[model samples]
Target: MSTLSTLKDRIGRYGVWSVGLRAEDPARRGQLAEAATELEQLGYGAVWLGGSSAARHAVPLLEATRTLTVGTSIQSIWDYDAETSAASFAEVDAAHPGRFLLGLGVSHAKLADQYRRPYSALVAYLDALDAAGVPADRRVLAALGPRTLELARDRAAGAVPYLVTAEHTAQARAILGPDPLLAPELKVILETDPSRARTLAREFLAMYLALPNYTNNFLRLGFTEDDLTNGGSDHLVDAVFAWGDETHIRDRINTFHEAGADHVALQVVTGGDRDTLPREEWRRLASLLG
Candidate 1:
């Protein structure tokens, strides 16, 4: 079977995880392992590690769990070469077959400026990935626009779009056709209070708002200039981040599923300064969603 087909078969249901792994805290390494184990035990299909994490960083997390797919929702294409990444994928697949998904992205002009050649560089990168023998089905692209989405459909399994809504999922599904994988990340703030939830959501969204790629995607989704300004408008906030009690969150996830998302990776947003305490939020969401 093709690698994408294998992924679809393995991740039979849906999955959830934080946006990124919090490896900055040395004390929490054991807790992170335990959390991975618990997430797998709870029946969540895959755990998505985010962009900031290194390819090597996910090894321990994958080793700590069994039968749960560990994926990089994205690793920057600029930071790592396809030959090295493909070798790593081969190593991980040999060690834990059908348990690793590599999500790749072109990143934004601002971020890609460090390496130069923002657009053409990505196409070259994809060619290199092919030349290096990274099978199309084993990887996914972090795409939003039509061109990148088309490239993803032709070159990789599908697309892994972050900071998107069910509406965007439906659009992406239309672009990707019937066979390729379409997994989009949803941010959920599990708080009932509107003011507090929006505050927390905006705080998490601040950095992304500054980034051009996210802003351009939001614009493509019909968000006006004013809506993208000042962190984000109410409509933009509500659409992007699902905030409320358990039932509300459940419905939100189902919205994405119903919109034709193959998998939905949920990022729990808690109203706290310390990232360490997200374990409570993760457990709560796992119980609610699992």
Candidate 2:
């Protein structure tokens, strides 16, 4: 089978583990490599690196883990040219064929404004990737709206919608049909205490609320303007973030699977000042999920 086809099959069979890469973390690089290795040891199918600058942050993690598939939950297409990105992809692919999935995005207009003409620039970028021989199936788009979803279907593997609810996953699945991959990132606080979990959830939601792309996505899913304001309403928080104990988090993951998500990438929210979060949480969760 083709690499993309094999990846789609693997995603269908085994769900994804997506982690964020925060620049603030001191042990970030080591933690990422360790996490990737541990997740692979735990038998998790894939590791998605988020908040990366194109493939720069992802390369080390990919180099560290042997068997696990690694991908950018998104690399801003505006940040790196297709030839450079494709060259990076080729270098990684040469070492680990079919193990790296390229998730590219137009990013938000606010962020894309630094480059000018966001949409047109993204189109030109995609054309460049095509010209550089990055196979359509080897890459996926970070899309949410209908138009971008259509573009993803035509030009890439599929869509990687971030911070989305299961309802939106179902809707996106319907729009993309059955063939293309639909792997949405789901945020989980993993705390048993409601108040504490909500606090962490809101803390994480704060920055995302300011991003228009995410706000508009929530709006399309029926959230009112009030729901988007002030660190998000309780209902909005509950809908976007899955909290509580392990059972609750697992149930939320299963909901997305049942809702027709080919793969659900789990972003585990951590507390305390430590960068790696004790590794025990990841170990326990991996055992529970595995």
Candidate 3:
């Protein structure tokens, strides 16, 4: 099997991305590990520590689970430099050979004070990673546009684009070609009421709307300026956050798979703190996806 195919086989196509995985307190870290172990036992392929996680954030999870591959959804280029990232990867790989994936990305300009010439910066980081002995097969780029996507294909194992539609997934797959892992973060709301779901979606999307990269991506996906105005249009919310029952969520994930995504990392959106583990929703989806 090709590198991506092998990694895909190991990681599985369904994974969970949760921002709460970074349990900094040494005391409660075991609880974090226990939660990850539960997911692995439940049969989800991998766990991606979301919210611009550092490489070390994945170590505890990898150390805890025997076979579950743990990765950073997008370790900020600004946060941990290539050398530190490589060092962290080395520590994890030494303990657990192939259970870690390094996810790299240039965060939003509004968020990162150092965000400048993202493409050039990403290339430089990848080059540094190469010099630091981090192989291309063990990393993924958080790409959203054509340039970054092409860079991801050339330099890394795959692209992990966030806040995107399945149509965007199809576009990215065509760009990355037949190889490279195409993993997209698919946010889902379990609410059945249309009004309630959209409200949650719009609220969740508000921050992203203020960010140019995401809004530009939406524009590229055929949404107008008005559609992006005031949170998001109903059409926009429906496309972005797959809401309603279990079948609806499954069908939406299938659309992404059909559109060429190798893995679909589900981010269960809810009113409560996303920093807390959404075990109930995850359990429900685990049953449904199975």
Q: Relative to the true structure, how large is the alpha-carbon lDDT of every model?
A: 0.80, 0.77, 0.89
Worst 10 residues of 2 by lDDT: 15-24
RMSD of each candidate? 2.0, 2.6, 1.0
Candidate 3 wrong stretches, greater than 4 Å = none
Cα lDDT of candidate 3 equals: 0.89
Q: Each prediction's TM-score against the native?
A: 0.92, 0.90, 0.98
Candidate structures ordered by lDDT, highest first: 3, 1, 2
Query: Which residue pairs collide, candidate 3?
Result: none
lDDT of 2: 0.77
The residue ranges of model 1 lying beyond 4 angstroms of the native Cα positions read 1-3, 19-28, 273-277
Check candidate 1 and list the clashing pairs. Answer: none
| Runs in model 2 lying further than 4 Å from the true structure | 1-4, 11-31, 272-278
Is 1 or 2 the stronger prediction by lDDT? 1
lDDT of 2 by residue, 167-273 (tens): 98898888888778888888777688988998888887888888888998999999999998888888998887878877888888889888878887777777654
* Full-model lDDT, candidate 1: 0.80
Q: How many residue pairs clash per model?
A: 0, 0, 0
